[model samples]
Each structure stands twice: as C-alpha cells, then as structure tokens.
Target: MRGQSYVILAIIFVIIVAIFAVINVDPVEVNYLFGTGEAPLILVILFSVLMGGIITAAVGLVKMIHLQREQKSLQAENKQLKETAGENQLIDDDNNQENPDGKKNL
Candidate 1:
C-alpha cells in the first residue's frame, strides 16, 4: 500500500542520516545557556532528535484530542436525527394500521 511505502522510505531516510552522522563525526559542541557543561556531537544530535520527536508527538496528541471531540459531537447529532425520524415514522404507521370503525385493521 501507499502507506507502507511511505513508512519504508522514512526508515531508509533515518538510517541514512544515522550512518552519515556516525561516519562524518562533525565536531559540534553544545553550550547550554544555563552554564551546563558542553555536550559532545553525538549527544547533541540525539537530544535534538529527541526534542523534535517530543514536539511532534505533542502536536499529534492535541490534534487527536480535537478530532475525538468532533467525532463525539457528530455521533450525538446522528443519534438525535435517527431517533426523530423513527418517532415520526412510528406515528404514521400507527395511523395507517388503525380502523375508523374502532377495530384493529392491521
């Protein structure tokens, strides 16, 4: 499926990035604004990736909550419409089955 291909592509891309990072060993030093000790290249890379993932997950969670609320509202509205239609139809059926001579004619 199309989704599977996308997932495969993402995996390939991550592997490539990891391989590139490990091979090229960039000399990156991280100096925290709060006087924290400098972090090595690998640690910086991992922390950056972790922060990105956390942000992405947080955004997804917010969207999921919003979607759930919308789905719940739509389901409640559908139930109300179905009940109203059923009540109207039941009234019409009872009228049709009744006899003018006060006898059941169903």
Candidate 2:
C-alpha cells in the first residue's frame, strides 16, 4: 500500500512539473516599496500551487478527523458489548449449582 502511494505521488508531482514547464510562460518582474524587484509570473504561479496544496491538505485532514472519531465510537461500542457478555457469563455461572468443596451439588 505504501509503495503504491509513493508511486502515485511521484506521478502526480511529475505531472504538475511537466504542466508548468509545458506552459513556458516568461517570468515577470515587479518593483515594490523601495527599489525591490520580484518576478511576478513565477511567484504568482508558485503561490497559487501552494495554496491549492494547502486547501487539499485541509480537506484530507478533516476527513481523517472524522474517520478517527468514528473509529473511537466503534471501539467504545465493542468494549461495551464485551463487558455485557462477561456480565451475562457471570450470571449464568451463578445459576449452575456447584458444591464449595470442589464438587457438583448433584
């Protein structure tokens, strides 16, 4: 499972990089404040990609949290079932007559 995930992740990364490269848009430069210059095209594209990744991660995180809550609820229910079964077993045991001296009452 882990290997497959790694392979898939690599493929996705390759696809993204290839897409960016294929577009081949020229990098734009911008000046701000006091004589500071920046490349507009690359910066904007990179920031957009980063934001998209962050949004995707947040969605995944929410899903994981929901699944964890469900798992906890199931575990609690299972424990309750086990306890009830044990209690029933004890009641059944008490109904069976047994002599205190390691023998049956019959």
Candidate 3:
C-alpha cells in the first residue's frame, strides 16, 4: 500500500540519519554574527537540516495558499458564467416561442 511505502521510506531515512550522526561525533567550533560556541558536528548538521526543512516547508505552504486562493476565484467566476449562460438561454427560448413564424423582429 502507499502508506506502507511511506513507513518503509521513513525507517530508511532514520537509519541514514543515525549513521550520519554516529559517523560525525567530533566537536567543532561554530561562529555566529554575535557569538561563537562549540558543538558536536552531528548536532550542527542536524540543526542545519532541520532549519532547511522548515524553510522549504514554509515556502511550499505559501505557494499552496496562493494556489488555493486562485482556485476559489476561478470557481466563482465559472459559477457566474454558468448563471449568465442559463439566463441567456431562457431569453432565447422566450424569443423563439414568440416568433414561431421564424422571422426577424426588426
């Protein structure tokens, strides 16, 4: 099933991250604009990955919201067009009935 595939992929991802963390255990100095500190290399890598994922998700969310708004606007426009078409059809039917002789009114 699709759900099973996702579960398998998640397990594989966890194993990969675990292997990465175990292989990178050395402490290293981290520098920032205002301060500096020492942290395990694995922690720094994990933090960077987490921040990247957050940023990527934020960007995707913004795009999804924009698309949803556009979809709603399109749906409203479609509904309006359908209503106008229905009104025109009704008027044409009335005109045809009044002109059963099949001649122009003008």
- Candidate 1 stretches greater than 4 Å from native: 24-27, 92-106
Clashes of each: 0, 1, 0
Each model's lDDT: 0.81, 0.80, 0.90
lDDT of 1 by residue, 22-78 (tens): 775556556678765655576677667779979999999999999999999999999
Best by TM-score: 3
TM-score of 2: 0.61
Best-matching candidate per lDDT: 3
In terms of lDDT, model 1 sits at 0.81
RMSD of each: 4.0, 6.2, 2.5
Residue 50 C-alpha lDDT in model 3: 80
lDDT of 3 by residue, 1-106 (tens): 9999989997898789878987999999999899999999999988887898799999999999999999999999999999999999988887666455787543
Candidate 2 lDDT over residue span 11-42, tens digit each: 89968865785575676665667786656465
Estimate candidate 2's RMSD in Å: 6.2
In model 3, the runs with Cα more than 4 Å from the true position are: 1-11, 98-106
